[model samples]
Target: MTALLRAAAGLIIWAIVFASLYALQGLACALGWDKWQIAEASLARLVLLAVYTSGIGVLALLCWRYRPRVSRRQFLDRLAFAGAAAGLFSLIYTGLPVVAASICR
Candidate 1:
């Protein structure tokens, strides 16, 4: 419900995205995805990470900017957004191996 907490959540989400992308790249290499596949997918992942964080940042800034009618709800909503984004990263991290294994076979 505070700006500090919202910003902290944003940074935590960013770190999760960074770590997930690094791990996924490693998995692709381990799976022997060619350079082209790895490069292409990496770029896509970067864009996804940007969009995920940017969306949350915008919401946080909006809460800070306008002090929305439902301020407490907006604060928690931003936190939930970051948490969901991190969850998405975790799912992708856990699933990439299964997906690559299936395809690599």
Candidate 2:
């Protein structure tokens, strides 16, 4: 149903975001931008963290803006809320490693 698809929109977007960022980190490392300096960190790592943080912010705003509608709509509509949570979790999961690992190695 359209409602279900709508509810799933966040998760779908998160999936794409996750995949794209994951691939981009890999590609950046392969291209040696991982070792390129930005400020105190490598360009690739900074980029990864910045992007992941931005994704979290966007998801948070979307959820907050839609919370009323999601809560007032059918119970099934709460799937959007869940999707937002999952998206946040995935973004954090993907970004955490960047903090611990050397970008180029």
Candidate 3:
């Protein structure tokens, strides 16, 4: 497969997997919460988001390892690229949350 197609597939699968994990984790936390422990607490929400996002990073790395396009020469290069992509995505994804935290503080 071409690099573009591979990237797109990787991204699509990553998105779906992450979204499901996020939903399940959030739901589990909500279900386990006591009446006084609101699901919307800032720190709790942060924990969920952090876990969800880190899960995505780890999944992406695993995907990188299994990618068929990788050659021995290209292995480290591809892994580095995928890691950079994940890092960039995380930075952008959390931008709004960081800004909101700053404004609310």
Candidate 4:
């Protein structure tokens, strides 16, 4: 069970971050967060940026933490590391639109 969880943790975190960001984006748009300015940027943009940055940071951490060590040549460890790398790539690819595109529209 532990080994399976370790292998799947990265993908699981990716799903969670993806869903949370989607929900938060909707909420921000509905609440007119774009009208609220923070540091010359809309509150919605800043909030999304913050969450996106944190998600990236967390995925990076997981990648580092689960990296296969020279001594521990375990298949599960390698899988976990690969999962984290894939998750990081996916998160960046999917979330870039939020940063570059209009929030309300």
Candidate 5:
């Protein structure tokens, strides 16, 4: 894929991950998966956290890879940077609530 398209891929994946995690949270609560604990975290919360972390890592790598090319390829660099920003924002906005709130109630 083209660099810009590949950069956009990260944003697209972030959107899917955001939606899936939100739905999964609801489903987990309904099915009592939220109450299923692993260590100090509920199963649902832990799963969400893992997904969020991995997403950020991937996006960050993309950003880093494209960063040096900013002066050479403006469009691709901007797309990659934007994708990273979107990923970070979505993960923080959607994932932080799970940590601050009770998973099931």
Candidate 6:
């Protein structure tokens, strides 16, 4: 049971980050965060960037934590590491558009 949970942790975190960013984007747009500017970028963009950065940080940490050690030669460990890597890739690929694309439109 624990091994199964560990193997799936990366994907679970990815799903959480993905949903949170989506919800935040909608909330920011509805609240008119685009009207507020900080250093030429809209507040919405800044907030999204911060969240996206945080997500990346968390995924990186998970990847590091789950990385296969020399002594831990187990199938589940390898699967967990792979899952973490995949999750990191997925987060970056899906979240990039949110950071680069126009907000509130």
Clash statistics: count for each candidate: 0, 0, 0, 0, 0, 0
lDDT of 4 by residue, 31-73 (tens): 9999999889999999999998999999999999988799878
Model 2 superposed RMSD (Cα): 2.2
RMSD of 1: 10.2
Off by over 4 Å in 2: 68-73
- What is the C-alpha local distance difference test score of candidate 3? 0.51
Write down the RMSD of all candidates, one decimal each: 10.2, 2.2, 7.1, 0.8, 2.3, 0.9
Model 5 residue 41 CA deviation (Å) reads 1.9
Best-performing candidate as measured by TM-score: 4
Task: Compute the lDDT of residue 11 as modeled in candidate 6.
Answer: 87
Candidate 3, residue 79: how far the Cα is off, in Å: 15
Residue 20, model 6: Cα distance from true site in angstroms = 0.9
lDDT against the true structure, each candidate: 0.50, 0.74, 0.51, 0.90, 0.73, 0.90
Poorly placed runs, candidate 4 (over 4 Å): none
TM for every model, in the order presented, reads 0.35, 0.81, 0.35, 0.96, 0.77, 0.94
Q: Compute the lDDT of residue 5 as modeled in candidate 2.
A: 74
Stretches of candidate 5 exceeding 4 Å from the true structure: none
Off by over 4 Å in 1: 1-4, 35-105
Clashing pairs in 5: none
Candidate 1 per-residue lDDT over residues 1-105, each given as its tens digit: 465554455445546555655565566556555333444455344444455455455445533543334545666665655554554455445445433443222
CA lDDT, candidate 4, residue 47: 90
Expressed as tens digits, the lDDT of each residue in 1-105 for candidate 5 is 677676686678678778877887888888888778799778888887777777777767766765545257666667777777777676667767766877667
Off by over 4 Å in 6: none
Better of 3 and 5 by TM-score: 5
What tens-digit string does per-residue lDDT give for candidate 6 at 26-98?
A: 9999999999999999999999898889988988998999998999999999999898888899999999978
Model 6, CA-based lDDT: 0.90
Candidate 3 local Cα displacement, residue 65, angstroms: 8.4
